[model samples]
Target: MPSSTYLTPRLADLSVSERPQERLESQGPQSLSDSELLAMILRSGSKGRNVLSVASEILQESGSLNGLLKWSDAEFRAIKGIGKVKALQLITIVEICRRVRERSPVTAPILDSPDLVFDFMRQDTQNLEIEKFWTLCLNRKNRLIKKVEVTSGTASNSLVHPREVFREAIRQGASAVICAHNHPSGDPSPSAADIKVTRQLRESAKIVGIDLLDHLVVGNPEHDPLSRGYYSFQESGLL
Candidate 1:
């Protein structure tokens, strides 16, 4: 094996000709690899490993950038060389990325398409270990205003309430909202409780003047919710 003291040639290790920072400054962020982008966040490696090695380990263990974002702090900390501080650091970076994505211009015109709803929610909610209810507040034009986490739990109806859903919509001056939740079991099949909560939210939105556009249940694409003939409120005539 190579000497444990050898520092890996990560972005930080490159000279002005080879570094990601230099390349990004001269070229652009798109010029960098996934590991290079992640290495930039990692900054430095532990004693034996360099940032590239650390980034590789993270990618390998987590499976992908999406997988990295999906990992809990506890799961990240379980990595051989990662500790609590590093785990927090990794999660914080992911959180910032999420917020930035959330705040990005809604240049893409919103549609009533359930696929759009699924794509939007998949950016953050798909791989959560616990159930989380999210409300996507939209303007009259159907453009996104904001996305809020209403509640989190194991069961859909256990934590989500109509009051909490509409309160934020009213505060944001939203004309409509889309309710969504993720299934960690990789089945996007909406439960009976999901339907019940959605019905309640739809009624509340009616009373509050905020239209309920749709309620989407998301699971991993690998699992084939649609092909598996999972529940879609629109398809089921529940919407």
Candidate 2:
């Protein structure tokens, strides 16, 4: 019994005050460390390890709690104690977090500046392996009415049409629209095709009686030549 006890000092073996569930109830969720919160979710451990140690290993593999949001089911399952069911559950948890973050609030964000637009779209665009174009429909005050993905394409190119862009804006009854797309290569500089599309969109906006506020190319700062993480057509006098 002593050797077995040493081998598995599970949550049940821990003193009441030391247990994650007890601490959570007494001190609140915020009081728990990232690993402890994860331990609470995992509930148990395998072989000789305890749940807290297993949770710590998971965080170490992911680098941070935010990094874990981008992990896939396969990635979660690669860990020693994380079987198929646990992997699926973890993926579901991540998906729920993503949806909650994407839920619109009572006060919609005003995306008047390039910085604001970048921040609004960053989470949606992060870790994407291909190109995706988005249209942000806005009211007269530049507050977001809705966001729509107009197109998704390969690593190098995403087809964007003025029709698709303006159609969503018109459907939303938007007075203005901001267009954004990501470069998987991490360079935010607009390609020749991007410029040509923007010119076409500028003309279409006039015909449709909708303002084209800007066209933004999003990329990571480390890969962007300008290191700005994004390039704005309006700021460059292109729109």
Candidate 3:
């Protein structure tokens, strides 16, 4: 058989100017090819390959960087020269990219309908690995003033208190509030606890002098509840 890529020259043996690191530093990252960026991530390769060669092999097999999202740790490790550390690095890169996509400057909306509420928070909440509760504090005109996290809990459920939900709203001088929480199970069906919490918030809002516009549950559209993957208590007349 022809010699394995393991016998190829090490990445460090390449001309200094031609190296991925060197080019990235001198020419800016935008100047580099996708494989070159991944090469910097892979760092080096097995006996017959170099860093670029290994990164290229992975790209070819995976189709593109987006493919990395679908790959499990075991699948990453199965690639030649990829060990646990490298596999984790790739996975982390994918996660960082995903989170970056989620983050953006918050823009206020009219908050007049369930669809507006759902789309406003969906970008921040989709594909979460655990439950997270957030309160959207809005002004009297229904313009969003702030979107803040109240609590992050386990995969299936998050325990939240009315105090925790309204404390920030009160502090921000919000006239009304919208509560939202994700279901890691992707089922938007509200639990007894969910109903109880909504009623509790409703009662607390009456005392605090602020309206509870809605309590929205975010989940998978496939799980049921009209296949919308979201529920608004205000829309359903639950609140």
> All models: lDDT?
0.76, 0.91, 0.87
Of 1 and 2, the candidate ranking higher by TM-score: 2
Q: Tell me the alpha-carbon RMSD of every candidate.
A: 10.2, 8.2, 7.7
Which one is best on TM-score?
A: 2
Model 1 misplaced stretches (Cα beyond 4 Å): 1-111, 155-158, 228-231
Of 2 and 3, the candidate ranking higher by TM-score: 2
Pick the winner on lDDT between candidates 2 and 3: 2
> In candidate 2, what are the lDDT values of residues 1-239, reduced to their tens digit?
35375555767777998898998999999989999999988887777778888898999999998889899999988887888999899999999988888873778899999999999889988989999999999999999999999999997799988999999899999999999999998889999999999999999999999999999999888988888899999999999
Q: Pick out the ten consecutive residues of candidate 3 with the lowest summed lDDT.
A: 1-10
TM-score of 2: 0.58
Q: Can you rank all candidates by TM-score, best first? A: 2, 3, 1
lDDT of 1 by residue, 83-147 (tens): 88888988898888777877787575584778777766776864578888788889989988888
Candidate 2 residue 78 Cα shift, in angstroms, is 29
Q: How far is candidate 1 from the true structure (C-alpha RMSD, Å)?
A: 10.2
Q: What's the count of clashing pairs in each model shown?
A: 0, 0, 7
